[model samples]
Target: MSMVRYKAIIAYDGTLFHGFQRQPQGRTVQEELERTLSKMASQPIVVHGSGRTDAHVHALGQVIHFDYPKERPLEKMRFAMDTQTPEDIAVKQVEIVDELFHARYLVQEKVYEFHVQIGKPRSPFRRHYASYYPYPLDLAKIERALPDLLGTHDFSAFCASGSSVEDKVRTIYEATMVHDEALSELVFTFRGDGFLYKMIRILVGTLLKIGNGRLEETSLPKIIASKDRNCAGPTAHPEGLYLKEVKY
Candidate 1:
């Protein structure tokens, strides 16, 4: 049988795995899926993800594509892969697609969420799920600073050092924050065409700094103009980051 291209949406806890990519030294989301799928296919199966998430970054609707040696029903493949993979990783949806559907390149928009816990005592249950900040936050300051992030900008200041992507320009379609009173957490959502390595995390960190008065509210635009990573605040904790969705 000819190879069949399958597209899948998956979610993983990401706390224990190294990252989404397959690495020689560590267990990764791709390695796990490839291992299980290859066993079922009776041949090697390489999975291509929409994008790579750093270690400890969780996902709710991460998309991936791979080729199977033989054809199979989409539901059956989804069920088999879902059950066979480890407990933390879930194969949520599966469908056969055209061979041209490249998960990474064809992506049009990606949505990410960053959670921040702002309380006196840290909750044990949220240790690995949210970044904790005990400092007093000025919501107005953060709200005022957010408009600076909208639209297209050269975000080299927010990109992590290890990224090799030459083009640093990207558009931010949406950037908003919500305070979840029930959980006492600040949830930040960002929708963009593409993001640089650790861009969201760095943006969240800098925003938090602005909220806490560490950084001037008007300084974000200057920092972006500077295009200097050193001008940005520290990268936020990986645990609070989540790959929320990918749009075609």
Candidate 2:
């Protein structure tokens, strides 16, 4: 049978799914997407995602590419999946791309936003979408640490234990923290060449500590130099993390 490569942009709440990647048992974003494609195509379809996100994490612009057995208009394929897929996930866009355009490898950079609620009691609307940290933060402390994090560096300290990628180096294009006065939340946006397992969360966690005086602002440089996970701060919760966008 012949095949056509289809690229799709999808967004998911990620609250219910186990994770972005398929697991041995429970449901996942990839499994759900593949299942939807398999049912629609009347044959098994393999889908590959831009990256794997942990459980409870969300994505606003997750990318995927799959080989479809049937030849059909891109719009039809998108619509067919959008109307029938579960409510939490959505098909934002679809296109027929060059066969070599992999969703993962072709990615030029990725942007992730981590939200931390600073209010004493988290708002009902923001509770699930952002992480709640009631402690006071020293904004200037967090600010002072941002510039040191930019540029290419060996980020082994920020990544978690499971990653096997030998080259723990990644370039941070932009690392900015903005306070949303209306929401009373601290939003940290990280744009980078790539992120490793729990890297953003760890970086944010370290910054959060520095903001609260739990960790010194000068600790960032040493953490990067150490290249040891034990030297960094804890990994923040997954709920606050979001895969904002991936640019090719």
Candidate 3:
């Protein structure tokens, strides 16, 4: 039978896994996907992700691709995998695709969302998925600093320490901050060509700092110009981050 390439859209609650990538210890999305697919195929299988979402970071529509025998009906396979995989992980869609199609390399853009619970105490329901900031935030100030983040710039200041990627520049196609009064939560959404490790979280941390009067809004341009990681604010917690979408 001819080998066929299969593309899949997946969603996972990352709280249980070490991260998207397989590790020496602890569960991971990739490890589980490969293991389940390999069992069905009766051979070792590999799956590639659009990008890695850090530990406790959830994905609403993470994309991946792998190969399987042409004899496998994708609809049946998707159902089977969904039934067999852990409850936190779900195979949303599976399709046969062009041999050249690759999940990571063809990615044109990505969207990530960071959630923050503001004022008083953290919500028990959102504790594993939202960062809690007890202090009042100046919403207007946070909105003002967001525009400087649009367009292309070297975001070295917003990237985490020990990242090996040399190109620190990334283009922000769009970004916004919205306050959900009903939930008492502040939501930050980002769409970009790509992101460095912990980039979104660090960006949120800096915005929070600015909102709380710890960082000057006018200093944003200078911070980007500095290119030093020390110029940025603290790295926000991983739980508040979600890989909202992976655009091809």
> All candidates' TM-scores?
0.98, 0.97, 0.97
lDDT of each: 0.95, 0.92, 0.90
Error of 1 at 52 (Å): 0.8
Candidate 1 deviation (Cα RMSD): 0.8
Candidates in order: C-alpha RMSD to true structure = 0.8, 1.1, 1.1
Residues 42-126, candidate 3: write the lDDT tens digits: 8988999998888899998999998887557778988998988889999999888999999999999999999999977678998
Stretches of model 3 off by over 4 angstroms after superposition: none
lDDT of 1 by residue, 1-248 (tens): 78999999999998998999988888899999999999998899999999999999999999999999878888999999999999999999999999999999999999999999998798898998999999899999999999899999999999999898999999999999999998999999999999999999999999999999999999999999999999999999999999999999
Among all candidates shown, the one with the greatest TM-score: 1
TM-score-better candidate, 1 vs 3: 1
In Å, residue 166's CA in model 3 sits off its true spot by: 1.1
Give me the displacement of residue 144 in model 2, in angstroms: 1.5
Model 3: lDDT of residue 53: 84
Global CA lDDT computed for model 1? 0.95
How many clashes show up per model? 0, 0, 0
